[model samples]
Target: MMSRPLATALRDATLLGAALLDVFVHVTSDEPLRMAVALAAASLLLLRRRLPLLTFLLTLPSVLLSDAIFASLAALYTLATITRRRTLLAVCAMAYTLSDMTRWTPSPHLDLWNPSALITLGYTAATAAAPVFLGQLVQARRDLSLRLTEISQARDHERRLSAQAVLAEERAQLAREMHDVVSHQVSLIAVRAGALQVATQDAEAKQAAATIRRLSVQTLNELRHMVNVLRGSHNRPTELTPQPSLTDLRRLIDTSGIDTELTTDLPGDLPPTLQRAVYRTIQEALTNVRKHAPGATADVRACFEGDTVRVTISNTAPTRPALPLPSAHYGLIALHQRAALLGGTVTCGPTPDGGYRLRLELPVKQEP
Candidate 1:
C-alpha cells in the first residue's frame, strides 16, 4: 500500500488535473490556445516541486486565459512549499487579498455594501491571507525544530570527542608511571644481580645474586600486567594472572637475602585491589632490605581487622648504610597512589629497634 503522504499527493494531483481540464475545455476558442492550456495544466504537477516559484509565476498567465479554481489554489500551496524567497509570496498574497476586498461603488448591486458581495469578498481575503499566514507559521516551526535537532547532534558528537581525549590522556599518564616505576626497578635488580654474580666469591653472595635475578623476572611480569591494565582491554580476568598478594609475601621474603619468617591472619578471600597493594608493599620493603640490610633476618606479619587489611615488614639494622634503589623507584609511589585511590594508606619508616620497617593499611570492599 502507498504511504499516506504519497497517496494524498496522488489524490491531489488527480483532482488538480480534472479541475484544470474542465476550465481548459471552456476557455480556449481555438486549437492553438486549447493545446497550450492542456500542456500547462498537465505539466503543473510535475513542475511544482522542480520549479516551485516558476510554477506559481507561470499560473499568472493562466489567470488571464483560464478560470481554474483548484489549479490556482494548488499553485498557491506550491509557492508556500518550496519557498526560499518569502518576499515574493508575501507580496502576491497581499496584492490578491486587497483586490478581493470590497470598496464602495455607485451601483447598489455591485457595491461593497451588499451582504452577498461582502461575504464573497471576505472569503477571497481569507483564502489569500489564511494560506499565507498558516504557511509562514508551519515553515517557522519546521525550521526551528531542524535547528534544535542539529544542535543536539552536535552536542552528542562533542561529548564523544571529549571522552576519547580524556581516555588518551589517562593512558599516557599510566604509561609514564609504568616506565618510571616498574621498568627502572626491574633494570636495577638485573644489573645489581649481574654485578654480584661476577664479584662475590662467597656462597652467600651467589645465593643473593640468584634471588635478585628471580625478583627481576617477577618485576618484569608485574610490569606487563600494569601495562595491560592501562590499556583496559582484555577478555580474561586480571585476577587470573599471578598477582603479588599478601600470600606472595613468603615468596618475597625468600628474596630478602636474609633469614625470613612470615605469619598471616589474612582472610581466605581477598579483594584483588587490596591483595595487589599488600604484595607491592612487601616487594618494595624487601627490595630495600636486600639493598641495605644484607644478611639481616626479617619478619613479615599480615593481619586483617574487620574489613581492613595491613602488612608490616621489619628487617634488622643495615650491615651497610641503607639506600634507596640505585635508580628511581616509581613502584613505591605508584603503590602509594594505588592504595590511596582504593581508600587506603601506606607508611614506611625506620623501626625504633634499629630495623627498617614499612606498613600498608587498605580498606576492603565486601561483596553485598
Candidate 2:
C-alpha cells in the first residue's frame, strides 16, 4: 500500500504535469512574458493544498494573460474540498470567471453588449462553476464516510457493554446458589459431626468425628470466600460450576439427610431453565426445613398440572427446637429471583398444621 504523503506527492506531480502540458499547447514559448507567467502558475499547484487561497490568487494573473487556466481550476477545487466557507468559494469562482472573460490587451472602442461576447462570458462562468460543484461533492462524500465509521464504532462499544452486563448477572446468580445450597449442606455436616463427637464413647470414633467437624468448618470458610469473590461488585471474570437440574433431585434428597420423600412426574424434555428452577426450589425448601425444623420429615411433590408444572415441599413441625446458627437468609430471595426470571412464582408460608410449605409453579412454554 502507498503511504498517504507519498500518494499525495505523486498526485500533485501528476496535476502539475497536466497543467504544464496545457501551457505548452496554448501559451507559445516565443512570448517570453506569457510563457513565464504560465509556468509560474503551474508550479504554484504544488502548494495548493497547503495554501489554497494564496495559490488561487497567484494563478489568476496567468489566466488573464494567457489561456493556461488548468492550475487556477485545480487550486479552486482544492480550496472548495477543504473549507466550509461557501461565500469565499463563490467569490473565488467569480474572480476566476471575470479574469478568464477579459483579455490583457483590450481593443479601444470594444462593444459592451456584443452577442459573441455574452456567449463567451456565459461559457466562462459555467466552466468556473464546474470545479466548485465537483469539489463540494467530494467534500460531502468524505464527511459521510467519517460519520458512518463513527456509528459503527458506537454500536460495537454498546455490544461489548451488553455482553459484560449479562456475564456479571450470571456470576451473581452462581454466587447466590453456592451460598444457599452448598453452605446449607456443609453446615448440616458440621452440626452432625459435632453431635457425634460429643455422643460417641470410642476414642477412635470421637477423633474421626472431630476431624470431620474441623474439615467441614474449613470448607465452609473457603466456600464463603469463593462466594464473595464471585459476587464481586466490580464484575470481574470467574469460573462457573455446572447447574443442577431435576434429574439430580433424588441424590440431593438422599445426601441432605433430612428424611424427605420425593415424588416427581416431570417430562424428560423439559427446558434447562425450567428444570433448574424446580431443582433449586426443592433444594432451598429442604434446606430451610433442616435449618428451622429439627427432626422433622418433609414431603416433596412435583407434577404437571395442565400447562403448568407445580412443585410443593411441605414439612411437619419440628420435633425439637432448632439450634441457632449463622445465616445470611438470602435463600428464599434467591429462589424468588430465579422463578421471576422464568416467568414463574414462588410462594411460602406457615401451614395450618404448625408446619411450613413452599410451592413453585412454572409454565412449560415460557413467553418472550
Tell how far residue 355 is off in model 1, in angstroms.
3.8
The digit string of per-residue lDDT tens for model 1 on 156-270 reads: 9999889877876787688678878868888888888978988899997887797777778777877777777666532234443555665666666665566778888897588
In angstroms, the error of model 2 at 68 is 0.5
- Over 1-368, each residue of candidate 2 has an lDDT whose tens digit, in order, gives 99999999899899999999999999997989999999999999989988999999999999989999999999999999998999999999999988887757756233549998888878988999999999999999999999999999999999998988887788789889999999999999999999999999999899879877987997798898888877884455555456788778998897666888999899877898899899888988988898999889999999998889899999999999999978999999999998888888999999998999999989888457
Roughly what TM-score does model 2 have, to 2 decimal places? Answer: 0.60
Who wins the TM-score comparison? Answer: 2
Clashing pairs in 1: none
